[model samples]
Target: MNETKLRDEIVGLAKSMFDRGLTFGSSGNISVRLDDGWLMTPTGSTMGTLDPARLSKLDINGRLISGDKPTKEAFLHTTMYERRPKANAVVHLHSTHSVALGCLHDVDPANVLPPLTAYFVMRIGTLPLIPYFAPGDLKLAEAVGEMASRHHAVLLANHGPVVAGKTLQDAVYATEELEETAKLFLALQNLRTRPLTSEQVADLHRRFPQNI
Candidate 1:
C-alpha cells in the first residue's frame, strides 16, 4: 500500500480497535513497515482519535524523521521488526482479558494460552510470557526481541500482548484472537473445559503451514 493509504488504514483500524474496547485510554500502539522506514502512532495519542497526517515517521534506525514524536514503546515495534524480518506490522495492546491472564501467578510463562480453539492454534501457535518490565523500559524491548525471533505473539507479564504479522490486518486479527482466547481460558478455568489435544494442534499447523 502507498504511504498515505497505509497511514489512513492504520488509523482506521486503531480506531476500530478502540471502539470495540480492545484497548482503552492511551494504552496501545500500532505500526507498519514503510519503504522509507516506519509509520507509527504518536506518543500520548489516543488510538481512537489518531490523525493520519500527524503520525510519526521513523528511519530504519528508529530515529524520528518527521511528524510527531514516536511512542516511548516504539522500541517494542522496532525490536520485533529486527527479530522477525518478515513481520511488517506490530500491534501492542493493553486488553483486559489478556492482561488478566498475565497476572495469574501460575499461568504458564511459556505458551501462556492453551490451544482452546482452531483459530488460536492457527493465528497464534505458542505465546511466550515475558517477565514484567515497567512501561517503555528498554530492557523489555530486548526481552521481547529475543523471544519474538521464535514466536510472533507474546504476552507481557502483568501487561498485555504484542503481536507481529506480515500485515497490519493480520496483526490486528491475531491480537483480537489472543484477547478472545484469553477470555475463554479465564472463563473456563474453574470448569471442565477440554482443550484441543496436542495432536489436533499439530494437524492444524501442518494444514495451515503459513501460520507457523
Candidate 2:
C-alpha cells in the first residue's frame, strides 16, 4: 500500500482496538515500513483518536522527515525492522490483560503465553518475556533487539506485548491474538488445565514455521 493509505488503515485499526478496550488512553503505538522509512504513531497520541495526516514519518536512517514526532519507542520498531527483513510493521500495546499477566511472578520467559488454541500457535509462536525497562528506555529497545532474531513477538514484563508482522494488519491481528491468549492463560491458572502435548506443539510448529 502507499504511505497515505497505509497510515489511514493503521489509524483505523488502532482505533478499533482502543474502542474494544484492548488498549486505553495513550498506551499503544503502531508503525508501518515505507519506501523512505516508516509511518508511526506520535508520542502521547491516543490510538482511538489517531489522525492519519499527523502520523510521524521517519527517514531510512531513523531521522524525522515530516509530520509529528514519532513515539519514544520508535527505536523498538526500528530494532525489529533492522533484524527481521520480513517485518514490515510493528505494534506495541499496553494491553490490560497481557500486561497484567506480565506482572505475575510465574510467567515463563521462554513461553509467556500458553498454547490454548491453534490460532495462537499459528500467529504468535513462543512469546519471550523480556524484563521490564522504563517505558521508552533505550535499554528496552536493546533488549528486544537482542531477541529479535528468534522471536517475532515478546511480552515486556510489567508492560504489555510487542508484535512484528509482514504487514500492519498482520501485526495488529497478532497482537490481538497475543492479548487473547494471555487472558486465557491467566484465567485458566486457578483451574485444572490440560495444555497441548509436546507432540501437538511440535506438529503445530511444523505447520507454521514462521510463527514458531
Candidate 3:
C-alpha cells in the first residue's frame, strides 16, 4: 500500500478497535513497516482520533523523520520487524481479556493460550509470555525480540499482547482471536473443557502452513 492509503487504513482499523474497547485511553500502539522507514501511531494519541498526516514517520534506524513523535513503545514494534523480516506490521494492545490472561499465576509461559479454536491455532500458532518489565524499559523490548523470530504473537506478563503479521489486517485479526480465546479460557476455568488436542493442532498447522 502507498503511504497515504496505509496511513488512512491504520487510522480506520485503530478506530474500529478503540470504539469496540480493544484499547482505552492512549494505551495501545500500531506500526506498519515501509520500504524507507515506518509509519507509526504517534505518542499519546488516541487510536480513535489519529490524524493520518500527523502519524510519526521514522527512518530505517528508527529516527523520527516527520510528523509527530512516535509512541514510547516504538521499540516494541521496531524489534519485531528487526527479528521477523517477513512481518510488515505490528500491533501492541492492552486489550482487556488478554491482559487478564497475562495476570493469571499458573498460565504456561511457553505457550500461554490453549488451542481453544482452529482460528487461534492458525493465526497465532503459539504465544510465549515475556517477563514483565516496567513501561519504556529497554529490557522489555529485548524480551519481546527474543521471542519475535519464533512466534509472531506474544503475551507480555502483566501487560497484554504484541502481534506481527504479513499485513496490518492480519495482525489485527490475530490479536482479536487471541483476546477472544483468552476470554473463553477464563470463562471455562472452573468447568471441565476439551481444548483441541495436540494432534488436532498439528493437523491445523499442516493444513494452513502459511499462517503467520
Candidate 4:
C-alpha cells in the first residue's frame, strides 16, 4: 500500500478498534512497516483520534525522521521487525481481558492460553509470556526480542499483548482473537471444559500454518 493509503488504513482500523472498546484512553499502539522505515502511532496519542499525517515516521534504525514522537513502547515494534524478517506490522494493546489473563498467577508462561478455538490456534498459535518490565525499559525490548523469532504473539506479564503479522490487518485481527480467547479462558475457569486436544491443535497447525 502507498504511504497515504496505509496511513488511512491504520487510522480507520484503529478507530474501529477504539470504538468497539478494544482499546481506550491512548492505551494501544499500531505500526506498519514501510519500504524505507515504519509509520507508528504517536506517543500519548489515542487510537480513536490518530491523525495519519502526524504519525511518527522512523528510519530502519528507529530514529524519528518526521512527524511527532513515536510511542514510548516503540521498542516493542522495532524489536519484532528486527527479529522477524517477514513481519510487516506490529500491534501492542492493553486490552482488558488479555491484561487480566496476564495478571493471573497459575497460567503457564510458555503458552498462556489454551487451544480454545480453531481460529485462535490459527491466528495466534502459542503465546509466550515476557517478563514484565516497566514502560520504556530496554530490558523489556530484550525480553520481547528473545521470543519474537519463534512466536508471532506474546503476552506481557501483567501488561497486555504484542503481536506481529505479515500485514497490519493480520496483526489487528490476531490481537482481537487473542482478547476474545482470553475472555473465554477466564469464563471457563473452574468449570468442566474440553479444549481442543493436542492432536487437534497439531492438525490445525499443519493445515493452517502461521507465517508471521
Candidate 5:
C-alpha cells in the first residue's frame, strides 16, 4: 500500500482490534515497514484511538525522524524487520488468553499452542514461548530477533504474543487467528481435547508452505 493508505489502514485496523477488545489500554504496538523508514504506534499510545498523522516515524536505522516518540518496544519491531526481510508489518499485543497460555507452567516452550484447528495450523504453524523480560527490555527484543527468522509468531512468557507478516493485513489476520486459537486452547484445557495429529499438522504445513 502507498504511504498515505498505509497510515489510514493501520489506524483503521488498530481501532478494530481495540473495539473488539483484542487489546486494551496502551497494551499493544503495531508497525509497518516503509521504503525510507517505519511507521509505528507512539509510546504509550492506545490503539483504540490512534492518530495516523501522529504515528511515530523512524528512519532506516530505527531512529525517530518525526511524529511522536515510537513505542518503547520499537526494538522488537526493528528486530523482526531486520531478521525477516519479507515482513512488512509487525503486531505485538498483551492479549489476555495468549498471556495466560504463556504463563502456564506446562506450556511447551518450543511451541506453546497446539494445532487444534486447520486455520491455526495454516496461519500460525507453531507458537514458540520466549522467556520474559520486563516491558521495554532490549534483551527481550534480542531474543525475539534471534528466533524471528525462524518463527513468525512467538509468545512472550507471562506477557503476550508478537507476529510478523508479509503485509499489514496479513499480520493482523494472523494475529486474530492466534488470539482466537489461544482462547480455544484455554477453553479446552480440561476437556480432554484432541488436537490435530502430527501428520495432520504436517499436511497443513505442506499445503501452506509459505511461512513454514
Candidate 6:
C-alpha cells in the first residue's frame, strides 16, 4: 500500500484494537516500512485516537522526515528492521494478558506461548522472552536486535509483546494471536490442559518452516 493509505489503515486497525481493550491509553505503537523510511505512531499518542495525518514519518536513517515525533520505542522497530531485512512492519502492544504472562517467572523463555491451538503454531511460531529493560531504553532495542534474525515475535518480560511481519496487517494479526494464546494459557493454568504433543509440534515445524 502507498504511504498515506497504509498510515490510515494502521491507525484504523490500532483504534479497533484499543476499542476492544487490547491496549489502552498510549500503551501501544505500530509502524510500517516505507520506501524512504517508516510511518509510525507518535509518542504519547493514544492508539485509540490516532490521527493519520499526524503520524510520525522517519527517514531511512531514523531522522524525522515529517509529522509529529515518533514514539520513544521507535528504536525497537528500527532495530528489528535493520536486523531482519524481511520485516516490513512492527507491532508492539501492552496487551493485558500477554504482559501479565510475561511477568510470570515460570513462563518459558524459549516458548512464551503454549501450543493450545493450530493457529498459534501457524502464525506466531515460538515466542521467546527477552529480558526486560526499562521502557524506551535503547538496551531493549539491542536485546530485540539480538534475537530479531531468529524470532519474529518476543515477549518483553514484565513489559509486553513485540511482533514483526511482512506487512502491517500481518504484524497486527500475529500480535492479536499472541495475546489470545497467552490468555488461553493463563486461563488453563493447573487445569490439566491438553497442549499439542511433541510429535505434532515437530510435524507442524516441518510443514511450516517459516514459522519455526
- Judging by lDDT against the true structure, name the best candidate: 4
The lowest-lDDT stretch of 10 consecutive residues in candidate 1 is: 203-212
For candidate 3, the TM-score is 0.98
**lDDT for each candidate structure:** 0.92, 0.88, 0.94, 0.95, 0.90, 0.89
> Candidate 5, which ten residues in sequence have the lowest lDDT sum?
203-212
Q: Residue by residue across 1-212, what tens digits does model 5's lDDT show?
A: 78889999999999999999999999899999999989999998999999999999899998899989999889888988889888999999988888888889987799988889999988888888889899878899889987888998888999889999989999999999999999998888789888999999998888888552
As a whole number from 0 to 100, the lDDT of residue 6 in candidate 4 is 95
> Would you estimate the TM-scores of all the predictions?
0.98, 0.96, 0.98, 0.99, 0.97, 0.96
Candidate 3 local lDDT, 46-125, one digit each (tens): 99999999999999999999999999999999999999999999999999999999999998899998898999999999
> Candidate 3 — what's its lDDT?
0.94
What global local distance difference test value does model 2 have? 0.88
Which of the predicted structures, 4 or 5, would earn the higher TM-score when compared with the native? Answer: 4
Better of 2 and 4 by TM-score: 4
Q: Which stretches of candidate 3 lie above 4 Å from their native place?
A: none
- Of 1 and 3, the candidate ahead on lDDT is 3
Q: What is the lDDT of candidate 5?
A: 0.90
TM-score of 5: 0.97
Clashes of 6: 0
Candidate 4 residue-wise lDDT at 42: 98
Q: Is candidate 3 or candidate 4 better by lDDT?
A: 4
RMSD of each: 1.0, 1.3, 0.8, 0.6, 1.1, 1.4
Put the candidates in TM-score order, highest first: 4, 3, 1, 5, 2, 6
